[model samples]
Target: MNLADIPLRPGGAELLPVRGVRARQAFDNRDWVAVEIPVALEFNGIAHAVMLATPTDLADFALGFALSEGILLARGELYGIEEEYGPEGITLKLEVASAAFARLKERRRSMAGRTGCGLCGTESLAHVSRALPALPPGPSLSKSAVARGMRELASLQVLQKVTGAVHAAAWCTAEGEALLVREDVGRHNALDKLVGALAKSTLAASTGFIAVTSRASFEMVQKTVAAGVPLLAAVSASTSMATAVAQETGLTLAGFVRGDDLVIYTHPGRLNGQPATA
Candidate 1:
């Protein structure tokens, strides 16, 4: 399915008129702010987790959350999604395969909705991390390709450009064409939305890399590897745990990517223009 064809709510952002005062000077103006609402994800009529999101691309959010959270093994495991709105917030009811529901029941963790927290509902520390398979070898990206992709991703962040309060994730071809981009108030949610969109399409994950506008975290790396994408590049620094996980999972991790420069934290061989060491 083309991500552009997906139906989304119009509440991603709102413009509010406000008065600004600077050095005894006052002016009235309007400011665009990203909208965040409590979105509940229910699997098979069972409430699983709730998150604060921009309330757009929700179907993508639901599918991405399922994959990143390990609730569903594959896209086929999700049967359908229905949206319900109420005074309180929106609810996404997901119908999944019976086997997936059983697995969800086995590992019960309810997330408390927040923009910055990804591992909020863990019952134990052991559940914080999941076993991830090593990603298959992906196409090597050139320095020019990485630089171009970052520039394109920055331009594609329409929501961020408007509100300046949202993060974005983009999937780009090795030659720097952006295939899909998703934006949300939360960095993790943005990546999840992108992953879900990729999974639903016929795009080959091994042919490209995922780029983000936020700092890379362990959960971000986990989501990328879960989607079988071999490379993840971030515009900011990555966490220690994220770097470690990327190394263990054989996923190439790059950070601080801007204008032809990037720091390869793990699996540097995936990038073409790296200096050979003795």
Candidate 2:
């Protein structure tokens, strides 16, 4: 796939007037802020969840959410999607296959997800983790490659550069070259966007690692493993629960990616220090 053809930027930011103080000096100026609106998802006329997200790339968000959340086993289950814009928010109307809709009905749950909130309305501990295919051993990559991808992700985050409120998810190659990057106000939303984008792209997701700007969370690791990515690099620390998930799934998880240094939590073989996983 031609990388240039993929839509990278989530529309621009909004300039809002704000009063702020810097160095004990009060000043009034317009600041660029990320757009956050209620994005509702409806499958076969049934309401599923409502998420606060930036409005751009709703299509990717719709497809990505369904696959990552285990709503649809494959993209074919989603026949079509329509967007209905109301004064309150945007609703994504997804026309799914009967099998997919039936499955959704059986395991239905409602979630009014907040910004950066995952599993907000999970009813039970069992539903928190979904069964997915085990990931294969990933490429043997150097720590420098992971850092390179994370560093490149900084410049590629067009939305975050303007609005300090957003996070980014980037797909990087084995050599640590970032190819696809998606941004959102919520970290999970950004990863979902990237997962959706990867599903639609021709690139082989298994051959690369996913890098995120936010601290690693359980949902973040779950989504990355669900997408078949071998490694996950976070700009900050990893939680104990997230580390456990990575260990259980054989996913190489790395956190606190500052320059050349990163602490690998599990499946360290994906890095150059050890042999690659089989």
Candidate 3:
């Protein structure tokens, strides 16, 4: 799809004209800015949560949210999705299986108004951290592949290139080819869109890892682990909590992926080759 041809409102970003002052000089310019809005998600006619996100690729956002949030067990459980626009915000009404709907209600009864933080609505410490199965063994990626993937990630961020305020998440093969990429104002939202896009496709995720143009936070590691992606590469640093989670879940986490150098926080064996230097 040609993103340039798409309208801004539905495309999740907007370009606004503004006045700029630089070095005591004033001029007029137009800036591409990311659009953040309230998105209400409803499952089986019951309101679930409201998130602040970019309003594009909402279908993918809906499905990815459901899966990463553990509301639905499988993609098959999400029967339908209906979008409604109003003066307030956009609402995504999703039709899910009865079993899943029941689980959602039970889960919601314990907490309300979950934010996009990915852990905001948890009622207890146990709920804050979800138990994930050990990641299945996957093909090792070479340092060259990781370097290539980092280089490719910059060009793939079409939205970020325009807005200069968005994050991107991409799925790349072991050979460093980026197959799909999603962008959003929120890092978690970008990852969710990528996961949803991957889930809707017939691709085998086990053959690849994920790359993000943002710092590796705990929620980032959580979502990657939940999606069963073994390795995650970030353009910046990883938080201490994020590294701990990555270690416990057996997810290979790498940060500071600039040019040919990257720091592997866990599972260094998955990255094959001598570490590149500055």
Please provide, for model 3 over 27-132, each residue's C-alpha lDDT reduced to its tens digit, 9 standing for 90 to 100.
8998877777778898989887877788889999999988887888789999999999776678899999999998787666333332245666666676666677
Report the CA-based lDDT of candidate 1 relative to the real structure: 0.87
Distance (Å) between predicted and true CA of 29, model 3? 3.1
Per-residue CA lDDT of candidate 1, range 1-278, in tens? Answer: 23233234566887667798989999899988788877899999999888888888899999999998788989999999999987667899999999999999988996786899888878889898999887766566786787788899999989899998999999999888888999999998999899999999999987888999988899999999899887888999999999999999888889999998899898888786432221
Per model, state how many residue pairs clash.
Answer: 0, 0, 0
Summed over model 1, clashes come to 0
Ranking by lDDT: 1, 2, 3
The whole-model lDDT of each prediction reads 0.87, 0.86, 0.82
Cα lDDT of model 2 by residue, 192-271, tens digit = 98988999899999888999999999999999988889899999999999988888887899999988889998888878
Model 3, global lDDT: 0.82
